[model samples]
Target: MPPAHSTRPAIAFAVAAFGIGTFSLMDAAMKDLALAIGAYNAVLWRNGLGSLLTGVLFLGTRQRIPMLAVLKLHLWRSFIVALMAVSFFWSLTVLPLAEAIGLSFIAPVIALYLAAVLLGETIGREAIIASIAGLGGVAIILVGKFSGDYSDESLWGAAAVLFSAVVFAYNLILARQQAQQAGPIEIAFFQNLFTAAILALAAPWFFSMDATGEIPMIAAAAGLAIISLLLLSWAYARAEAQVLIPVEYTAFVWAALCGWAFFDEPVTLTTMAGTALIVGGSLVAARAKPKLVEHTEITTA
Candidate 1:
């Protein structure tokens, strides 16, 4: 029989899956906008709009921003998140949709291992085997592309995607800790404010001449990104690592569909193979039960 606390993480995984799906759609919209306005410009506008929305919500809900201590964490978190967004979007422009999505799937596995390292959680036999199997699957899927015209440029893009995954894993660990202490709304508000500030500083360096036609799409993307981040943060705060990590893979299905519908990216056997391994690993991890520990504690960073 499953433990009583297991259900909460299961519920959180479900929510995270939905949020990832929504984010895929949002990425599709942003991709189109980026094509018109450039990736940097799109990011700038989206972050700015998202920050404004967060500001309004904070004011309306009567939530107060914390002292400099909390503000410092928010700033660092925002910088990393912004870097993540830029890198991921830049990769979107180069790699084939399926390849990009496949590589992005590496993050959850990274997070699973990191949980063991940073949070002192155990990586059981099942998870280790699952991780190796998942890596094998990814290698098999990319076997053909090894000799193709995949120049150093594409290689860098792949590296960027991997690096982004690492930062994202770190970001999640921090955000999850923060969420445990504060309400989701408080976390969301500070994240937006911090992201906005960082992007605003970056705007002059990255801004372009195409903002006029791209504002609407940027606005749409901002809304989706904000909502997705909030949902994911809230869900992670309530959930355990083993369960929630697997569900994040649902982003690929969403990415594949969105890539096909918007970017005309085709599905192939490799994608199916990689996706299968990912799902299998997730299922194995989800089913395993780790010994219960003290409840997670959250504090203002």
Candidate 2:
């Protein structure tokens, strides 16, 4: 039987999978709503309502909202998150949602490398091999796009998604560090607050009230947004890089399904091949034995 603490990482992995799937589905739903309404409006409403809900919930819970010192980190992280959202949403407009989402899984690869370089954890041979395989998978997918079904902007879209992935990996590191010093609520609360502030400036020019004549759609987006964030926060606070990274790739599964079902974009052989490599490589990384000891001594008298 595996040690008890071993289960903790496994539990975190489950939570991260939920986070990935829920967020992907939520994003797809938001994109559909945005198309009916408008992108800027969807973004504005989601951010505004999400920030409001977060603030209200935080106040109810009485978490010590991080002071200015921590707020600086919050702002920096929020900036990254804002950029990521813009890039991701824009990419979804140009690229097949599944392909764009597949590329975004590169964030986990970035996170693994960052964990080694920035956090000073040793990069194991398996991780290096997995990274190479994952990159090869991405190349295969991109090469297939040369058949001309995709647009010239698809390349830029892919690049944007990849950049977002990189920035978001750094965000994960910052969130993990903050989680150690404070509760997930504090980190989440300030994240939404600062993200709201950054996004609010953009709203004046971009915001709109036209959303398919559906207030319910806006409310649905808000609910999913909150669910996504809560799951992400809960998972990030608990999981190790290896476990979390693998699970994050599952987001593409949600995207692929959503895209196919809603947009009628047929899944191709190339997608499957690339997805196999990416998922396989991520699994290899996740399956690597965690070096940290899993069991602690009990104070037996």
Which prediction has the highest TM-score against the true structure? Answer: 1
lDDT of candidate 1 at residue 196, scale 0 to 100: 69
Q: Tens digits of per-residue lDDT for model 2 on 85-150?
A: 777777777777887777776787788778777666667766776677777776676677446665
Question: Once all C-alphas are superposed, what RMSD does model 1 give against the true structure?
Answer: 4.1
Over 4 Å off in model 2, which ranges?
1-7, 149-152, 212-214, 291-301
Give residue 227's error in model 2 in angstroms. 2.2
- List per-prediction Cα lDDT, in the order shown: 0.71, 0.68
| lDDT score for residue 249 of model 1 | 66
Give each model a TM-score. Answer: 0.86, 0.83
